[model samples]
Target: MSTNARQQLQHHLRNARYEVLPLRGTLEQVQGLPPGTTVTVTSSPSKGTEATLDLAARLRGSGMHVVPHLAARLVRDSAHLDELLSRIEALGLTEVFVIAGDADNPAGRFTDALSLLRGMEEIGNRPHRVGITGYPEPHSFISDQMTIQATDEKARYADYIVSQICYDPNTIASWVKTMRARGVTLPVYIGAPGSIDPSKLLRISMKIGLGQSMRFLRKQHGVVGKLLTRYTPENLFDELSPYLVNPDYNIAGCHLFTFNEIAKTRQWAMETADRLQEVPA
Candidate 1:
């Protein structure tokens, strides 16, 4: 790696945010993370926003910077949104990541992230920092044009963009270039899988509509085999290092999808950061 790339990689690794699902054992794993670590709690249809908020509150109490996912479709209506925002404010949290969500049907008038964002604006209690999703690779259901248009629209209300977990660094780099060309200036946090078990990672990827990215991984020689054995973000991080170092990309840092493997993810991040900082023999 170039000197700049190495330095940038270490810097991002040091400040990376961890995305964790609000499931059983998540609290304990998050509690084990280094103090003041930024953790984004995910909301799912089954768990509902309550689960995400509950986890975010607990994590915040544990002294971590918590960013909870507010799945638009799961939110009922204006009253519900107000209640959620109130709870968030009560916890002294000021960051949230919004998504259209995976629900087959909307539970309220806010069917998408854009609408939810508008609602927040109307309510006038918006979080200090709002993050929206970006897809480097094509979304499973949304067309490329639509995704691009959606992102451009969402950019107006968002503080930054966090891309979906994509394994291919080239695609991510190209996507960043495209976004810049389109005049979307928000700094982007590249999403990547943490040091997760191969089997579990694959399972979760499919469950969360990452099939296209997984298919891209399968095309890479030996990647499928590696996925069956062990998976790490080192290769992906290295490949994207040059772009991460470039100011034109406006890359913020990494958003590691830890999938609740907090300990392993933390170890990998620390080790990689240290390795990059070490002087060569």
Candidate 2:
């Protein structure tokens, strides 16, 4: 590996953010993370937005920088949005990730992230930094053209973009180049799975619209076999290393979808950083 690639990988591993789901043991798992670590909390249709905000507040109290997900379909209306905003302000959080959510039915007026972002703007107490999701592969429901156009519109309000977890580095790199070509200047955070079980990863990935990427993985002989034991983003990092230091990619490190496997993921990250540092320039 080139020296600059190694250094860039090390830098990303050291500063990567963790994405955790709201569950029974999630808080305890996150508490073990190093102080000042940035943790993004996910909002789901089942848990609702309240669960995300509550956990975010607690995580903030624990000295971690928390970015809560504000799912558009979960919010009832302007009043609910105001309440959530009030709690976030009270917690002094300045960052949030917005998603359209996987809810089957609309909760209220806000049906998508763009609308919720506009609502936040109208409400007048928006977080300083807002993040929106990007899809490198085709969404399970939405078409590729629609996803790209939606991202372009949301870019006006978002500070950054966290791509959906993708298994292929070439697809991701191409997506970044496409976005840049289209004049979307937002810094891109490549999303990849952390150290996680293959079974669980597949189930979750299929659940969240990563079908195309999953198909790609299946086509690669022995990839599934290796993942059957354990899955890590090592290959992903190595494959994307060339773009990490390239200015055109505008890569802003990584967003690890830990799937609440915090300890394993953190250990892998630390070890990887050490291994990269030991490499000769």
The C-alpha lDDT values of all candidates are 0.90, 0.90
TM-score of each: 0.95, 0.96
lDDT of 1 by residue, 156-216 (tens): 9999999998877888999999999999999999899899888887777776677656777
Q: Ten-residue segment with the worst summed lDDT in candidate 1?
A: 221-230
In the predicted model 2, the residue pairs found to clash are none
Expressed as tens digits, the lDDT of each residue in 1-281 for candidate 2 is 78998999999999999999989888899877888999999999999888898889889999999999999999999999989988898899999999999899879999999999999999987888999999998888898899999999999999999999888888999999999999999999999889987888877787777766767777875565465455679888899999999999999998999999999999999999999999877
Residue 56 lDDT, candidate 2, scale 0-100:
91
Error of 2 at 11 (Å): 1.0
Question: After TM-score superposition, what is the CA distance of residue 69 in candidate 2 from its true location, in Å?
Answer: 0.3
lDDT of 2: 0.90
- Error (Å) of candidate 1 at residue 157 is 0.4
Candidate 1: residue pairs that collide? none
Best by TM-score: 2
